[model samples]
Target: MNDPIVKVEKLSHRYSVQWAIRDIDFEITKNGIYGLLGSNGAGKSTTMNIMCGVLKQTAGNVFIRGINIRDNPVEAKRHIGFLPQKPPLHVDLTVEEYLRYCARLRHIPKQEIEKAITDVMGRCAITHFRKRLIRNLSGGYQQRVGIAQAIIHNPEFVVLDEPTNGLDPNQILEIRKLVKEIAEERTIILSTHILSEVQATCDHIRMIEQGRVVFAGTVDEFDNYIIPNTLIVTMISMPPADELRSIPGIAGVEELGGPKYRLKFTDGQDVKERIIETSVARGWRLTEIFAEKSSLDAIFAELSKK
Candidate 1:
C-alpha cells in the first residue's frame, strides 16, 4: 500500500488560555478531497494553519510525506500549497503579475516562470483575466486567483480553508469544480462549515467538534451514522399511527409535516418492503415512500446541542 500522504498525531493547539483544539488525529492516505468539517470556532482554521506551517501547534506533530513539519519546516512546506480563509491578495497587481510573483516566491526556476503562470491560470480558468487587477476582479474571479496561487507550484498537498465562504451559488459551484479538478494529482484538504459542500465534494469526511474529531468515515458512512434505519412516508390515505405501530420492531411513527411521516425502526432494519406490503394490504393511498436519510443539518444540530 502507498504510504499516507499526510499524517497528523496527537495534535493540539492552544490560545492564550483555552485550547483551540485537543488531541486531533487523522491521515490522508491518497489523492482525494478530505474535508475538515466543523462549525465556527471549532478549531478547523487552527488545524489547517498548523498543517500549512502558518502556525505552531502547542503539542503533537504534523507530517507531510514522512517529513515532520516542525522539525524540518522548509522541506515539509515545499510539498504544500495553502489558501487561508481570507485570501492574501496584492490588490494593486494584475492577476498575471500576482501569480508570477507567487511562482517566483515558490521558487519556480526563472526560466519557467512565464509558462508556470500561464499553465496555472489556464488550469484555474483565469487565463482571460490575467491582465485584470486583483482588486478589480469579481469575488469569484478573485477566488480563482487565490486558487491559482495555491496550485502554481504543483505541491503534493493543498490545504484550503473555507474556499467558498461568501460566494453566490454559481460561484460556489465553480470553485467546487475547480477543487475537484485540481485534486486529480494533489491530496487536497478543505475546511468548511458547509455540510452540503462536504457531501458534494469530498470522498471522505472528518467531522470535528470542540477541537476533536467526532466522526470520521466516507460520506455514505456518515449519513448512515445519522440516519441508521429510517423511512419517509407521504400518504394520501392512511391508518392511525397506532395501527401502523402494530408492525413488529417499529419504535415510533413520527409526524413530519402535511401528510408526511418519519418512521423510526429498531435495530436499524430497512423494512420499506414490509411497510409497502402492509400499505397495499390496507389499500392505503401512498403517494411517495422514501428511505429516510438524516440531513447533515440535523446531525450538526444534534452535535451542537451536546
Candidate 2:
C-alpha cells in the first residue's frame, strides 16, 4: 500500500493545565473518507488544528505526504486544505471573489487563478452562486462556497471540521453529497459530532472521547465492539420476569414494561427458536422475534464510558 497521505504519531496537545488531546496516533490514507467522531469538547477541534498547522502540538509529529509539517510548513501545507466549523467567508465578497482570493493565497500561478477558481466553483456546486454575495446566499450555498475555497488549489487532502453544523436536514444532505463527490480522488477527514453523518459518509471511523482515541477501525469493526452474539426478543405475552429468566440458554432478561422483555443468550445458543417454541407451547403470542445488530450509538456510548 502507498504511504498514508497524512500521518500522526503520539500527538499530544494541552491548554494550560488541561490536556485537550493525549498521545493520539492515526493515518489518513489516500482517496478515502475518514470520520473523526466525538462528543462535545472531545478534543476533535484541537486534533484537527494541530494536524492542519493551526495549533502547535505539545509532542508528537504530523506529516503530510511524507513532509513533516514542523520541518517544512509551507510545502507540507500546500498538500492540505482545511475548512473550519465556521467557514472563514468574507460575507461582503462574492463567491467568485472569495475563491479567487483563496487561489492566490494558495500560490496558484497568477495566470491559472481564474481557471482554478472557475473549476472549484463548479466542482463544489456553487457555480450558480458565483456572483452572489456570501451574506445574501442561503446556508447551503455558503457551505458550498466554503468547500469551494478549501479545494481551490486542488490539494491532496481536505479536512472539514463539522461542515454540516447549523444546517437544515435538506442542507445537510446536500453537504453530505458534496463531501462524497469531492472524496473521489482526495483524502477527506470529516470531523463531526453527528454519528449519523459518519454512518452515511465515512468509509472508516475513529471515535475520540475526552482527548483520546477510544475506537479506530472500519464501521464494522466499531460495531463489533458492542455486545457480540446477542439477540433481543420482544414478546407481548412474555411469562413472568422470573419465569422468562428460567429458559434454557437465557442468561438474563430485562423487562421493558407491559409484556415486553429483552432476553440475553449464552454463547452458541439458539435462544430465539427456544423462545418462540416456549411461547407457542404456552399459547402465548410472540409479538416480535428478531436478531438485533449492534448500532454505532451503542458502540459509542460504551466507548465513551472508558
Candidate 3:
C-alpha cells in the first residue's frame, strides 16, 4: 500500500507562556490543493513551519510519506517544498539567476540544472521575464517567481503560506490559477485565512481557529456545516401564512410582504418538494423556490467560535 503523502499527529506548539496551537492533527493522501485555513495569528504558519521541518514542535510528530520529519529531516524534506509568508527572495538577482541559485540549493546536478530552470520557469509562466531583475517584476510576477522557487525541486508536497496576501484582485486570481495548475501533478498545502481562497482553490480544507482544528473536511462539507433552517419561495399568487404552514414539512410561514414567503422547517424535512407540490395542488402559482445557503464568512465565524 502507498503511504499517505503527509501526516500530522497531535501537533502542538507554544511560545513562552502561551500556546499557539494545541493538539492539532490531519493527513493528506493524494495530489491536490489542501487549504490550511485560519485567521491571522491562528497558528497556520506555526503548523506549516513544523510540517516542513523549519520549526520544532513542542509535542507530536510530522511524517512525510511515512518518514519521520524530525528524525530524518533531510530525507523527509526531499519530498517537500515550502514558500513561507515572506518569500525568501533575493530582489537584486534576475529571475533566471535566482532560480538557478535555488536549484543549486536543492542540490540538482550541474548537467541538469539548466533543464530544471527552464522547465520551472515555463511552468510558472515566467519564461518571458527570465532576464528581468526580481526587483523590477510586479508584485504578481514576483509572487509567481516565489512559487517557482518553492517547486524548483519538484517535491511531491508543497507548503505555501498566504501566497496572495498583498496582491491586487487580478493578481490574486492569477496566482490562484497558477497554484491550481501546479497541483495537477503534486500535493499542495495552501495556508491562508481568506475564505474565497479556500472556496475557489482547495479541494479539501483543514480550518484552524484560536490554535485548534475547528473544522476539517471537503469545501462543500464546510460550507454546509450549518444546515439551512429556512428557504425562500416566491410566487405570483401567494397563500395565507397559516395556510402555507399547514403543509407537512413546514414548521412556520413568514409573509415577506409581496409575492415572497419564508419557510421554516425542522430537521429531516423535505420542505421544498412539499411546498412545490402544495402550491401546484392549491393553484398558488409557485414562481421560484430555493434554499438559502450559508455564506463562507458566516461559516468561518461559526467555526472560529468552536
Candidate 4:
C-alpha cells in the first residue's frame, strides 16, 4: 500500500509560556484539498508554520511523505510548498523573474528551470502576466503569482495560509477556483477562519479550537458534527404551544410570530417525522418543516466546549 503523504503526530507548539497548539494529530493519504479551520488565534497559523518547516515545533513531529521534518528538514521541505498568510513576494521583481528565482531556490536542474517556470505560470494562469511587476498586478492576479511560486517546484504537498484573506468577493471566488484547479494533482492544506471558504474549496477538514484539534473528518461530517436541536416549522393553522411541546422528542416550542414556530428537540430523536405525522393527524396545516442549520460560530463554540 502507498504511504500517507503527510502525518502529524502529537504536534504541539508553545510561545513563551503559552501553548499555541497541543497534541494535534492527523494524516493525509490522498490527493485532495484539506482545510485547517479555526478562529483567529486558534493556533491555525502556528500549526501551519510547523508543518511547512518555517517554525520548529516545541514538541512532536511533522512528517512530509516519509521523512521527519525535524530530522531532515531540507529533504522534507522539497516535497512541500508553502504560501504564508503574508505572501513572501518580492514586489520589485517581475512575475517571471520571481518565478525563475523560486525555481532555482527549489533546486530545479539548470536546463529544466525555464520549463518549470512556464508550466507553473500556465497552471496558475499567470502566463500573460509573466513580465509584469508583481506590485503592479491586481490583488487577484498577485495571489495567482503567489500560488505559482508555491507550486513552482511541482511539490506533491502545498500549504496555503489564508490565500484569499483580503481580496474582494470576486477575487476570492477567482482564487478559490484557481486553488481547486491546482489541487487536482497534488494535496493542498489550506488554512482559513472563513467557514464558507472551507465549504467551497475543501473536501476534508481538521478543525482546531483553543490550541487543540477539536474535530477532524470529511467536510460533510464536520457540518453534521453538532446535531441540530432546533427546527423551523411554518403552518397555516398554528397549534397551542402546549400541544407542540407534547410531541415526542420535542423539548420545547417557541412562537416565532406569523405562522412560524420553533421546535427544540433532543439529539437522537426523529422529531421531524413525529412532527409531520402529528401535524397531519391533527390537521395543523403544516406548510414547512426543516431543521435549523447551526451557524458556523455555534458549531465552533460547541466543538470548543468538547
lDDT of 3 at 55: 95
Candidates ranked, most accurate by TM-score first: 3, 4, 1, 2
Q: Model 4 segments beyond 4 Å from truth? A: 267-270
Candidate closest to the true structure, highest TM-score: 3
lDDT of model 1 at position 245 = 84
Please list the C-alpha lDDT of all candidates, in the order they appear. Answer: 0.88, 0.86, 0.91, 0.91
Model 3 ranges off by over 4 Å = 246-258
Question: For candidate 1, what is the TM-score?
Answer: 0.91
lDDT of 3 by residue, 96-137 (tens): 999999999998899999999999999999999999999999
Position 206, candidate 2: lDDT: 87
Worst 10 residues of 2 by lDDT: 227-236
Task: Please write out the lDDT profile of model 4 over residues 1-306, one tens digit for every residue.
Answer: 376899999999999999999999999999999999888889999999999898999999998988999999999999999998888899999999999999989999999999999998888888998899999999889888889989999899999999999999999999999999989999999999888899999999998999998899998888888778899999999899999989988888889999999889984467788899999999999999888888867777788773
Off by over 4 Å in 2: 228-230, 234-244, 253-261, 268-289
Q: In model 1, where is the ten-residue run with the lowest total lDDT?
A: 267-276
